[model samples]
Target chain A: MPKGKDTALMSWKEVPFGCYILESGNSVKFKTGDWRSFRPVLDKEKCIKCGQCYIMCPDMSYNQDEEGYYIVDLTYCKGCGICASVCPKGAITMVVEEV
Target chain B: MLKELAKFKGFSAKNLPKEEPFAPGHRACQGCGEVLALRLALKALGMNVIAVSATGCMEIISSPFPYTSWRVPWIHIAFENAAAVASGVEAALKVLKRKGRFPKNRRVDVVVFAGDGGTGDIGLQALSGALERGHDFVYICLDNEAYMNTGVQRSGCTPYGAMTTTSPPGKKSFGQMTWKKNVPAIAAAHGIPYVATATPAFFLDLMNKVKKAALVNGPAYVHVYAPCPTGWGSKGEDSIRLAKLAVETRIFPLYEVIEGKYYITRKITKPKPVEEYLKLQRRFRHLTEEHIREIQQRVDAEYERLLRLAECL
Candidate 1:
């Protein structure tokens, strides 16, 4: 079996006592980007990098690069378009996610 | 011994904290305001805190048995006793500090995050008891207005004329028969040190109120307006927009009560029509003109009543 797979279906002895999650912030392993029909594309030239996208995002998918540009980590972005809408510079555009 | 809290000047849009205490990944719908409020609350409290959440959308979405999104110390408790558990935690921490078991110099905030059902319905008794007994904790009720985790059933905090699974509007019934319970007012009535109302749309206001809640020496209650897009039949991107509209329309006013004195936080001079706010969410789509008028009247009366309270201060 794959390591760290869901142990709910496993035998009682194999499961951890009291359904305890030993590791913290382990939800990063699960990608939720597939759920969105649209994806936000950032315009580097137009982006002033106010960090609105980073602060307002429901999913903590946006990270600041070396240039301080708020970039989305697509693995965890749910594509809510909150950043696109809240951006004062209107630097983010949501395009149809290509399957 | 009561320690003096460090004064926070305030947070402007430009200078908000960069720390993201609530991690992302397990599952919350696109543009969930509940998670947004939760994240802002944790940011305000910072890392020196222990959060206790009830069985609701946040607890279910963030922790899925094997995974967790919390970076700080967290405990998941039953649906009704979040406040009860939080009080016990506060008492234990006090004892531990007194006995020299825990560090006396370090002050850790104990916070409770619960939904409307957990705070206004099932958990009201325990919350009241904690408030009356003066527990040094902050209880944030993420009011999505329904039992959203269990597929949007109506709760006591659900507003009138809004449709939910159990309170669907039909030929026989007109959505929820009762008005949204004023839980913040109820908390303030306990004569607690701090009580406030906030929404995710106003990030600065929310963070300030939450931080103040932690600063107070006694129990503090912050009722946050948590918008549920999937449950309310609204577009995913419209969640934040809807939250803003709800406040502008006077449906959810932002204010804080400190020791029985009311202070309006974001005062709206020219309020929008309640119908404008209602039209965005399909849950209120079924309301007729009469229903809209009724809702508007109620909103005006409530706002006026709050204005009267704040006027004295």
Candidate 2:
């Protein structure tokens, strides 16, 4: 389903008043990853693919690859270090950004 | 560092599912406790839910102009009628499903997220009405204990002896003279299916309570201890620490009432003094040692009463 700008393109009268989007799952337009001061780097060799990062991330930044290994989607990751803190095997490391 | 290590049990993270209905960005302050609670609550509720938010901090921050942070179907209505709006939505969904207008497989959970002022003071009537009518929805009170969105005014849930903008400490008076309202007990009195108190510091306990509330057949109430750094005069980073201390000091115990039976979910085995919780925030700085002792005694008495209720039940 079309969302964001397309929904905004629709007639104002047609859509419900008060900033109501016509469809769900439309938060992609807002990039919040810039809010991060630290970025998480995964040590794939030691990851064990427990899917801990995928499950525990508050931002839902982790996705499973075709081989079922979890990868961080940095587009929306605020780098809260929750995934790192929750990783039992210590496979994830948080790197401070130079900026 | 050891304290942080002991606070989190890593294994519990494995149980959480990766679905972000409440996205980051928009306009929450750094380390916002209410936003954290909303994130976790939405995580537990998943994508198949409709959230009705009252006109407060969450609503203002999430819905501005043509932008929204909610990835799910969300509504921002008046401050006092989120429950009413949710009840309408649930009723519409029910009738639509029964009349075959909606797909048979479609199951949408209706949830209301309101602040302490909205839930405990302004919206109390609508909430009570909905709960009494037994709407199949969850009413979550993000109890930050004051009117945070409107310049940090005192509310019904604001604890006794805390300084707010309106309840400022003066030469002749202390701040917020009355005790915090026992909202969970009020919800339980309606004989609802579930009523619980939770905090974002205890992720497992909070998520579990939210999940249970979402699945219950009747009205379910989950009061979350959402500490507001801006209102409480604490550092933004101390949000989680203050929340943990609130629980640890027995000021906000984790408990649930299922059909009038009380169950203390998390016990403070080695409880700290209320001052440990109060000293961190400037809101309580004006309080003297005598005032602190009074608050401590009140907390002890309330906790003991809760324990007795749990034991008797």
Candidate 3:
């Protein structure tokens, strides 16, 4: 088992006694994760990256990695479709992730 | 103490209940003015009334299947039929009141809430029908200036040269070309018992108008200028301040049309320039110098017209 999962399981015995707690346990679930995630899939074929998508996205979900290529962070993406629509090159498509 | 003396002399503050009729957990965009309007309207009306909301942001957010943000008995009808629905409810309540079928012969005032698109555009016919038919109900148009729920599309209430999804400000175009439809004027033409324009920024004025409209025997129309933060690219909390500026600028005059007479309530001693109101929202960002002059001219013309009406009465 993973270290976090093992910690969670071991903490159950201490929960009833109210004496022990695991600091490394994955007990906290972020409330915002339930909201829909929109990942921008770049179509390199239509590759005139004008950076409009990067500028328009309110969440700052997209950034160029060290390789100088745009990468999207899906964790905080609200799927507002603003980035895709603002892309002048139409190089980005918003994809919904399965729950 | 002076504080104790002040309290003794009818200066004690009453605590308003924190229980919101429009509860949290419903999905409305951050800083939605329509929700604020509904909440305030409900607060004024209290718990004894039933609300009929049109198919807009308020309805979509408040009523979803078995879940509801509304603590009061609320109904969401078709987009254009909120007034008509409220009329029916009022009629039914009237009949029940006559028959003494209601609990303790209580009277339920029917209140209809709708957006600008629902009122000035799609729902105008139904609203006219209700008004002409002389229903005992209050109809409120929470005018946020556009079809915000449908992704900030331009509606008839959208001002001239204001950008939206439908009226994008492009190199060749100056956003929306048409002026906002004068909905209160049209409602006034119906010669209803009461018709008024209000804003949430003036809470007491809004509450008093609502109370007067509620007590009126026949149909009453209240058009509230609700600011949309997300749609207008403005700060959410600036809604009330913008509403106040709208009134101060004379873009939305706080006035009442009562029984064929016009009364200008809360008139500004020195009206501010329309630019003060227009400059705050990004919707009017495309407005040129010529456009601003035209808007100022129109605002002055409308203010003069209203003043003439007040003088006539």
Best by DockQ: 1
- By TM-score, the better pick of 1 and 2 is 1
Worst 10 residues of 1 chain B by lDDT: B1-10
Q: What lDDT tens digits, residue by residue, belong to model 2 across residues A2-26?
A: 8766767456666677555654545
lDDT by residue for model 3 (A68-91), tens: 556666654555565565566778
Report lDDT (Cα) of residue B310, candidate 3. 93
Can you tell me which runs of candidate 3 are displaced by over 4 Å?
A1-99, B1-19
TM-score of chain A of each: 0.84, 0.78, 0.58
lDDT of 2 at A78: 73
Q: What is the lDDT of residue B281 in candidate 1?
A: 91
Proportion of native contacts in model 3?
Answer: 0.00
**Tens digit of per-residue lDDT, candidate 2, span B1-313:** 1131234442255666666787655567655778878988998889999999998999987866556788888878998999999999999999999999999787789999999999999999999999999989999999999999989999999999999998999998899999999998889999888899999878878988898787667889999999787899986656777888899999999999877888899988889999889998999999999999999999999999999999998
Candidate ordering by DockQ (highest first): 1, 2, 3
**Two-way DockQ contest, 1 vs 3, winner:** 1
Global CA lDDT computed for model 2:
0.84
**Which pairs of residues collide in candidate 1?**
none
- CA lDDT, candidate 1, residue A43: 98
What docking class should model 3 receive?
Answer: incorrect
Chain B TM-score in each of the candidates: 0.97, 0.95, 0.92
lDDT of 2 at B278: 94
